[model samples]
Every structure is written in structure tokens, then in C-alpha cells.
Target: TQLLEQSPQFLSIQEGENLTVYCNSSSVFSSLQWYRQEPGEGPVLLVTVVTGGEVKKLKRLTFQFGDARKDSSLHITAAQPGDTGLYLCAGGFGSYQLTFGKGTKLSVIP
Candidate 1:
């Protein structure tokens, strides 16, 4: 029942650097998810955190959900040019519908 908000609406970094993005909300959620999308393609789900304080990692990418279930974060290590994309955070409230944040656009330059 909460709306997610993402920070750093836009980001640009050089390859091999690390970066982190955040999503926050005032209302609690049952679950939260992170996704990555390219310009012409649909978003690809990266991770889902249902339990508070949960942390998931995919290679060099790490995702974490806050203990209060009202916030989340994503971190990328040694970012590469291919890592450039739109990062989205969505929260679910035990239903099929999901409330998404204003996606963070990332640009990794070589």
C-alpha cells in the first residue's frame, strides 16, 4: 500500500567504479523487488526480498531490504560499461499489483 521512491534519478560513472542506489517509502510492504532494463527491452527481475533485513547478491551486484520493509538498496562493484541500464524498484502488498519507483538511470562509461 506504499509508493516506492528511488534516489539519484540519474547516475554516470566510469568503468571499474562502484555505485549504489536507493529506494525508500513511508509505508510498509510485504515484498520488494529490483529490476534492470535496457533501452529497448523490458525490465528483467534481479532480486526479490520478502523478509526484512534480507540481502541477496548476483555476481557483483548486491541487493538489500531494510529491517522496516520501507526501504531498499542496490550496490554494484567494479561496474562495467555493460552494467548501464535503468534500475527499478517495486513494492508489493500481498497482491498481484506492484507499485514502482521512478527508475534510476545508470550510465557506465568506458
Candidate 2:
């Protein structure tokens, strides 16, 4: 089974800090999706990039898909307390089930 692996399983930062989270895999995917999940709530979609080397930005967060489609990265510029959550990256297509990384939990303290 294919899977996504995330680095730095946990992170703690004060408000207005910057951080980067990584996701990796051995298989290529047609598309990739990034989601941010809060405690006791379903993950909310942040962005979906279909093409390799695609980059998308939301507010202070930037997401990039590796040119090989085997990895991705999330870079946050000047993160705020609201950015604290579980950052998840998922890749797959159809109903085959979306594979999610172990997740990077970010805590931005005020």
C-alpha cells in the first residue's frame, strides 16, 4: 500500500513565527491535497494541486508539489496563533481511499 510520511511530527512556535513541514512518498500521484484539521473536527481542505511542480498559496501558507509528484512541502510565513492545527497531506485519486501522512502538529503560542 502507498502512503505519505511527514517529518517533524510535532512543532511548537510562538506567534508570528515561520515553519516548514514536509511530506514524502515512494509513489507518484496524479494529484495531491493538503488539509488542516483541528481537534475533534474533520480536516478542512487547504489546497489541491493537480500538476507536478504546482504551487498554491493561502494567506501566509504556501504549498508546493514536487516535480516528481512523490513529495510535497508546506511553508508558512509569519504564522499566527490561528495556524495551530494538524497539517495533513493526502494523495490519491478516485474512491481507492485517500492516503494521509502521519501529520505535523503545529502549535503557535500567542
Candidate 3:
């Protein structure tokens, strides 16, 4: 199984600031997914990138997959306090094996 490594283990920013978090791995993944978890809830899927060089945008957030399918990133524009959460990146290997990163804990101050 390939392991995903996330950068900037923790981030604290003021409202309306823009920031980006990255997920990287040495091995290529068939597919990669990004999730967001709140204080006491399960992680929620934000976007899944199956194709290399693909980009998806959700509202003020942008998701991108590396051309080699070995990395990914999430960028938040004009971030708000509600955006505070733990950002996780998962790499899909075989049938259902998923390797997750340690996640970046983001604290958006209002």
C-alpha cells in the first residue's frame, strides 16, 4: 500500500485568507480523495480525483490532481471560520485499501 504524506500538519489563518494544503506520495495511486472532518463527526468526502491533471472546484475551494497521479492539493479562497476542520487525503490502492495521510488541522479564526 502506498502512503500519502500531507504537508503543513497544522494551519491557523484569519478569515478571508487564502491557503493551500498538499498531499504527496512516492507511489502513484489509481485514485485519490480528499475529506474534511469536523470536531466530532466522521470525515466527509470533498472531492475524488481519478484522472491525472484533473481539477475540481467546490464553491470557494479548489482541488487538483498531479499530472502523475502521485499528488494532490486543496486550495481555499477567502476562507471562513466555518472552514475550520481536519483535512485528510487518502490514496486508493487495491479493491478497497486506502492509505490516509496524517491530515492538516486547520483553524480559521474569525
TM-score of each: 0.96, 0.94, 0.97
lDDT of 3 by residue, 57-95 (tens): 999999999999999999999999999999999998866
Model 1 clashing-pair count? 0
Give the C-alpha miss distance for residue 1 in model 2, angstroms: 1.7
Give lDDT: candidate 2, residue 80: 91
Provide C-alpha RMSD values for all models, in order. Answer: 1.0, 1.4, 0.8
Error of 2 at 35 (Å): 0.6
Residue range with the least summed lDDT across 10 consecutive positions in model 3: 91-100
Look at candidate 1 and tell me the lDDT of residue 78: 100
Q: Mind giving the per-residue lDDT tens digits that candidate 2 earns over 1-110?
A: 68789988999998988999999989887788999999999999999887899999988999999999899999999989999999999987554657888899999999
Residue pairs in clash, model 1: none
On TM-score, the leading prediction is: 3
Each model's backbone clash number: 0, 0, 0
Better-scoring candidate (lDDT), 2 or 3: 3
Candidate lDDT scores, in order, read 0.94, 0.90, 0.95
Index of the highest-lDDT prediction: 3
The residue ranges of model 1 lying beyond 4 angstroms of the native Cα positions read none
| Alpha carbon deviation, residue 80, candidate 2 (Å) | 0.4
